[model samples]
Target: MSIEQSWNRITRTLAEHAPATAKELLPPAAEADVRAVEDVLGQRLPVELFEWWTSCGGGLHPVLPHGYIPYRPIGSASAWREWTRRHGDGPQKGSAAGLPGAGWHSRFVPIATDGGGYDLAVDLRPGPLHGCLFAFSHQWGVAYPPEWSSLTAMLGGVADALETGGPVGRYHAETTRGGMLVWKL
Candidate 1:
């Protein structure tokens, strides 16, 4: 299904099963805000990610929790800059050279985190990896190949897992107080 369809399914499920948590989602991002992020990053965000921000502005939601804080466009830019500053160089020379390490590539923009210093990011660099979704950890580095081809697919998988009680890879569907469904690791 399309990203809009996936978003609809996700929101509908959340409203039905976890209304309270759904209410916590941030307002849709403004176009200007998205532009601001692009200005900061010095490159445009992927179409899918732009669509996602415009449709559902990043915020706390039933499917994503604290460590998984979704980034508002501006927030994402700032966080990327900060992370680069703190971890620009690798711990061991050549150990993480040219790979995703302390100084992550400029093309990768963090979209969310696992609350344990790991991040879910969008790879915006050119070539084959463009638009791919990745999972990165501060300690372990990039988690192999791309996890999803696009943000739409990733969100769709999350929606599917929420609807079927199926696993979304390492995460599982979990319900908390007030019958709210969330993805838990």
Candidate 2:
């Protein structure tokens, strides 16, 4: 299936569950938002990325909790802005729930796309097992533990039933750090 198709599936699933914990709803990164993405970096997204995004869907760190946010470079900017305005402070020392909760990185990477929203990227390679990486728009990750291992592995699961063709995964990251890296993959 295409990324949009997969996103529809995920969103449908979430809708059924309704009010899934903040960790359950995976986000969306779509080709429809290509204009928005292009606006952000002032460069067209690589064809490979478009194909990957249309096919692989958004970035979902499988190891994260169900409520964990996925990488969504598309959505309502106000939502993310509101989220930050209300909970801009990272996380506390011990708090686990709510915005600016403990272990979460502060500030989301701002992307200027056509339809503008946020981009949340998750790195799967490297060590330290698995952990939340990108957070833009209304989505961000916490520095908890990993149950998966790598972001690539998580993408693999989403593509298990995917048809042939298209890029292997969704958006890519430009750097590492604990914030939302630019979409390079």
Candidate 3:
């Protein structure tokens, strides 16, 4: 299914199972906002990500019960720049330096965060890994091999888990609060 269809399923499930949480879903982002993010980043966001932002602006959406806050337009641009400064090459790499192959690069753009320090990013580098979803931790570094091949696939997994009481991609269903299910590591 398309990301929109998958997200719709997730929202329907949330509305049925956790009405209050569903109410927290943010509205779609404006086209101008999305364009501004691209302009700032000097890169075009992957189509799936663009669709996601245009359909559902990044924030507290019920679909990601794991607290993965997808960055808003400006938030995304700023985050990529910040992560690049801290983890990308150069002397500013700082603490992230000398980590035995653990560091961020320019092509890896921050998409969502667990509201802690962990982030889910899109690998925009060329070649096979392009468009893949990666899990990045400030404490541990990027989880190699990625978490999902595409954002659409990841969301599809989440929808499947919600519908079947199963795992959501690499994460497992942890608990439920007020009828809202939460996924965890």
**lDDT tens per residue, model 2, 115-156:** 233333332222343222343333343323332333334444
State model 1's lDDT.
Answer: 0.69
- For residues 1-185, write the lDDT of model 1, one tens digit per residue: 77667777878887887787677778889999988888888887767878877877877643553236677777787877866666545323433212343446666788876667677777776655567777667555443357777777788887887788787767886778886666666
Cand. 3 Cα-lDDT:
0.71
Candidate with more favorable, higher TM-score: 2 or 3:
3
The residue pairs in collision within model 1 are 67-115, 87-102
Measured by lDDT, the strongest candidate is 3
List clash counts for every candidate, in order: 2, 17, 0
Off by over 4 Å in 3: 61-66, 90-101, 139-143, 174-177
TM-score of each: 0.82, 0.32, 0.84
Q: Least lDDT summed over 10 consecutive residues: which range in candidate 1?
A: 90-99
The global C-alpha lDDT for each of the candidates, from Candidate 1 onward, is 0.69, 0.36, 0.71
Residue runs of model 2 more than 4 Å from their true location after superposition: 1-52, 56-72, 76-79, 91-143, 158-185
